[model samples]
Target: MDLHEYSRYDAVGLRALIVAGEVTAAEVESAARRALDRVNPEVNGLASPVFETALGHAGAGPFGGVPFLLKDSGPMAEGVEFFAGSRSLRGVRARHDHDLTRRFRAAGLAVLGLTTAPELGLSYATEPARTGPTRNPWDLARGVGGSSGGAAALVAAGAVPMAHANDSAGSVRIPASCCGLVGLKPSRGRTPTGPDSGDPAFGALAEFALTRTVRDAAHLLDAVQGPGVGDKYTAPPPPRPYADELGIGPGRLRVAVTVRAWSGVAVDPEVAEVTLKTAELLAELGHDVTEASPALDWEDVVHGTEAAEAAIAAPFLTAPGRPDPARLEAVSRALLAEAAELSALDLVAMLDAQNRVSRVVGAFFTGYDLLVTPTLGELPPPHGTLSSGEEGHTLRGWLEKLFAHGPFTVVFNLAGQPALSLPLGHSVGGVPIGVQFAAPYGREDVLIRVAAQLEEAVPWRDRIPPCFASKP
Candidate 1:
């Protein structure tokens, strides 16, 4: 298969070709490797390439033979190096396959390698001191949003149809917004963090993947959505396969639109214009659209997130033979200090705040079926704009900077609701702009339905980036 032919297909499309004997899985995998080789140099998306292992893989299932990449910050796959974009965990490998990784393999996604991330998955920019930066394919000088930033960049550049991504405070959706891809942060517990952790980041993290199309997102959710053994909680199951949700009209539902972020970060005019236009389009599509926002104490959200992050960092930072300060990034060191200062009472306060915010947002959702907002407050910033390696950052101050760039996404992580970012619009400069659609808890079906509608309404599939893998 040629790079152009390979790049045009989504995961499902590729799987169909493999299933029909039109092309073998090996051929598809070869095309993916070629695509990766062609683009990874320009985008710097691959953190660890395991191409040899992928060649030996003969996956079987709905997506059998589909090329996939795992994020360096994991849903761990045994034997693959697991670095959460930090030097502290450098050279470490998972002893066991994370439940989600097993599920990906079972569903027939051939794991190619690991993608880049910000150190400890902290920043919205994927410029880790350990792996440099994963540049945005749309504009090489800008960043692909972080944590899942590498996954987003590869998928955007047509290296792979979809790849593993996780979100705690917008890691998945932020990068999706920046890269013109489909980033679905399933409801908390919709996918597992299991045997290693019942819940990561105090139930704030949601494990999933980034894809180019809404149907691909839906199909993947169908393949991987379920609780793992010993999970702390499980999301209510969808009534049917998530793939069935596609092509179904969402009906005339109540949709709330807000360009103003609760954190009071000023939305860029271009981003605000895209979001408002999306709302108008929803109205045009016959939905009841209204300007409404749930009341939130931005401090509570920020504090709770800080506490969760500190807790996540504690185990690593306090471990036997913990990484030296020189081995860790500045923000990570700051996090270690913050974790040391955190008391049990601080965690309790975080839970209290989480409960309060979830309750308020839950109530708001009782009235509105969906909420529309810009995925990020600003466009994808230039490299160095949000570096974790930069010195002298207090944990709070660093989070403030992070939230300012992505004020719209972390709230839903706090609320444990399902949210998705779709590349629905673009800037006049030709960079993609993402508009996020969030649903109430356990309502991914709603998100998929609406996202598919928008996918059809504002077609972004043909809008390839200049640094595309297929381009010569």
Candidate 2:
């Protein structure tokens, strides 16, 4: 198959060709490798290559022969290193498929490689001190947002149709917003985090993917959405397959829009402008759009995130023969220091606060079907702008800096709602800007329906970035 032709089809289209015997999985895998060769060097998106392993598992199943990338953070395949973007875990290999990874394999996604992430996924940029930055495909000097930044970069650059991504405080949506793709964070407990540990980071984290199309995201959720045996929780099952819901009308709905950052920061003017424009578009599409947001305690979000980070990082800090202090990033070290001081009582208090915020946000959703907001406080900022530099940063200071990178996103993580970031606008500087649509728990169906409608109303599929791999 011609490389250009190969890059044109999304996962479903490629799957159709494979099923009809028009293109073999091997040919598609070869095409993906070529795309990676052309784009990965410029993008710095991949952490490691597993092309041979992908080749070995290319054919059969529903999405047979489709090239895919798995983010380095989780959903790891056996024998593959699960580095989590740190030199500390460089030699730690997965002994078996993470339940999510097993489902991806069952769906016939050929996992071509692992993608880069911030060290310990503690930052919003994909610049791990060990792996360097994953450059934005649209602008080389700018960053690809993280920790799913590399996954977004690869998909944006046409290196693969879609790749694994997850969110804890908007890892998936942040990058998708930065790179012009579809990123959906399924509701808490929507996807498994088991056969390893339950409730990743106290249910603040959820796994999903970054895709170029809404249907691709929907199909993937279909493939991987379920509770593993002994799961601590499970999302309410969709009435039907998410893919089947794509073409369905969302019905006339009420959407509350906000350009103000819930964390009390002013939205970047360009981002705000685009958000209002999107609200207008939604109104035109027959939804009741109003400028409103829930009045929840933002402090609760900050404290909850701090506790979760501490709980998640404590294990790494206590691991034997951990990375030398010199190797760890400043923010990561600060987080470790803070986590070490946190007690069980402190965690309980934070959890109570988080649950209160959840209840508050959930109550607001009763008045509105969805909440619309800017996906990020600003366009993808310049590299190093949001980084808590290597010196003199305290844990509180570092957390503030990181939250500022995505002030609008983490609230939903706190609420455990299904949120999606859609590439709906561009800034004056021409960087892509995204608008987020968040729905109450177990309501991804509503989000997808609206996403599909907006996709048709303002199509972005042909808007390729400058560093794209498939450009003729």
Candidate 3:
């Protein structure tokens, strides 16, 4: 296979070619490197390039020689200087290989570099002072949402089929929506977050990646989903290999679709149109689709959800001995301040409230296999829309603003359920739009299966942005 062609292949295709010996992993790495050279300049998606190590590790797993990038926020790039899109740790380097990155390498992905992310994964837009703006491949001026913004940009630009991304909030889905890709944030504990901390508070959310192809996303989930040696929790065992289950038809799901969020913000007309269109498509596929919503107390969640999430996220704020106070964002600072004032009673109240929100959502699943909504209420934001360095709004206001802008995707993080963002719709301006589908807790197999089903319904693989197509 020509390197040019390999650059365009999705994970499955690249792996097949590598197995067939028609192409070598080295060649894929080379092609991906060339792609970075061609596209990174225009998009600023790649934070650092690493082809040499990738070449040495080609033909390693199911995705041998497949080009991929890490989002720079998670545990994967230990000893490799992960900036996490913040100025505070601009020169930080990974001291060890996170098990997740090891698993990714073992699965045969030749990771050639790191993708861009916003400061501390705090903002949805990916422009950081350390790295210039990571432009959306679809529209240069438009944002490639954070913190996986850079990965979205690169993959949308065809630099790679997929890249690693995680979402505590909508970090993964927001970018996937902006860049037109499939992003699955598996159930909490579906993927490892280990060694440093057992879980990031509330046990609500964890790590996963975004990809351009549903099949690729599903395949990686199979290769990587499991608790490492010392994880706090594990998603209940999947019914079957997710890749295998994709072949099984999703018999008429009692699909409940809601375009309006708990916040009372009307879903953007464009997002609503696509969400409804997707529901109709699901109905045509013989699934029962209904317009419905759960009793989501949006005002309550948005008013103080960050405080709850922050309380859960406290350990990660400081290391064992010397705390890295510099990396704390304004929102983080606000939460810490609140946490100090919180008593045992307040802690109980917070946990109880979080559970109640999840219960409200879970009850709806009793009547439906899944819930569908616009992944983000609005479209991709302009760069710097949610800056956190104490600008005008208070830290809580900034976070609340983000929740308002992206009201749809974070509840699952709170619900501890498996949710996925499927890239099946678009705005009239041609910006990519995403629809979120969530399954009950411990049923990632269902989430991935439905996502694959939708992938077949409305294919997005061919919508590669012009920036990527130009090189190939």
Candidate 4:
């Protein structure tokens, strides 16, 4: 295969090719560097290119020669500087390889670069004013869903088969949905988080990568998803080799479908159409899919789950002798100010509400193997809506817009279950739309099996974005 072909192969596919002696680690690394040199200028996805570092590290493992990129948020691969996409962390460097990075290397991935994220992984769209916009490979003028937007763009453009991304509030799934790829947020504690921290945010979530194929996600999970030494919450044991579950096929699932609550944001007709079809598709797959609204008060403002996330994120933000306090944007500053005023009772209320939401959501999942919803209620907003520092927009308004439109995602984050965002549909103007599929906590194996089956049913691998060069 040519270098271009090497660029397009997912990790698993690349492994097969290497075992067949069709490619070498050096060849794949060279291909990735060339592609990064070619495509990154327009997309602004690559934050820290590590071509030489990757070339030196290449060789051995299942993915020994396959190329990859990582989002800059969680931790850095050894030798590469990790910026976390902020002005404050501009020159900071990693002293050692985080566990996930070491596992990926052991499994044979050649890390070539780091990707862009919103400042401190705060924003939903990756249009940072400092490093400029991380443009969607599909539409350079549009915003790429962040904070994994950088990883998503490179993978979508066939620069690499897969790249690391972490999801807090839909970070992994959002960018994967935006870029028309497969993004899976494995259950909390499914993957090891060590060296810098263990289970970021007390087991509220976990991290992984977005990929072109379901098998690629599964293979990576097989390679890297393991219990660390001191996990706060432990997921159930995965079936032997997550890839084997892909072949087993999902049994008939009790699938539930829900629409976005009327948040006053106009639902894109294209998204609605695809969401309805996706439900039908699930039903056709011999599963029960019902168009039912979830029973709960989503709009209740009882100092709820959002506050819990804020509380979990505080020490990292407020820690002394770290990123300078003055360097934070006004939005972060304002949030810190609001957090300061939160009393003990306020925190108790937040934790209590989260418990309530979890109880309700958990019961709902008990009756179903999967719940399907639109990943986003609408298409990408016009650029500059977020991080523009625009006025008359309360933080509540901004957050409500994101949550209502992105209803299906954070529920799982709160419940700490596994969720998958599959880019299966397209808008009339050719923008991609994603559908969410979630299973019981630690049941990522189930979601991956069904998704691989669905992917075969409706092949999306051939769908290429307009902005990416089809032939390099």
The best candidate in terms of lDDT: 1
Let me know the TM-score candidate 1 reaches against the reference structure: 0.98
Better of 2 and 4 by lDDT: 2
lDDT of 4 by residue, 1-472 (tens): 4655765567887778778887766676677777777778878887765556662343667677788887877557665777666666656667788777888778878777788887667677887655777888787877778778899988887778899998877888888888899999988778876756754643555679999999899888998887766756667888688988888878888888865642345556788778789888878889877766446556532235457446544754666435564665545555555666778887777767667666777788878788887787777655676763443444455567566546556666666789899998987777789988888878988898889889989989888887553364
Give candidate 3's TM-score: 0.92
Evaluated at residue 55, the lDDT of candidate 4 is 27
lDDT-better candidate, 1 vs 2: 1
What would the per-residue lDDT of candidate 2 be over residues 63-108, giving only the tens digit for each residue?
8779999988888888887778886665887788888888888888
Residue 283 of model 2: what lDDT? 94
| Count of backbone collisions within predicted model 2 | 0
- Note the Cα lDDT for every prediction shown: 0.90, 0.86, 0.76, 0.74
Pairs that collide in candidate 3 are 61-108, 78-94, 79-94, 79-95, 80-94, 81-93, 81-94, 124-146, 201-312
Candidate 4, pairs of clashing residues: 63-108, 64-108
Candidate 3 residue lDDT tens string, 102-126: 7887887777778888766767778
Q: State each model's C-alpha RMSD to the native.
A: 1.2, 1.4, 2.5, 2.4
Scored by TM-score, the top model is 1
Ranking by TM-score: 1, 2, 4, 3
Off by over 4 Å in 4: 55-58, 262-266, 299-305, 308-321, 388-397, 469-472
Tens-digit per-residue lDDT, 137-235, candidate 1: 999999999879999999999999999999989999999999999999999889988888866898998899999999999999999999998899799
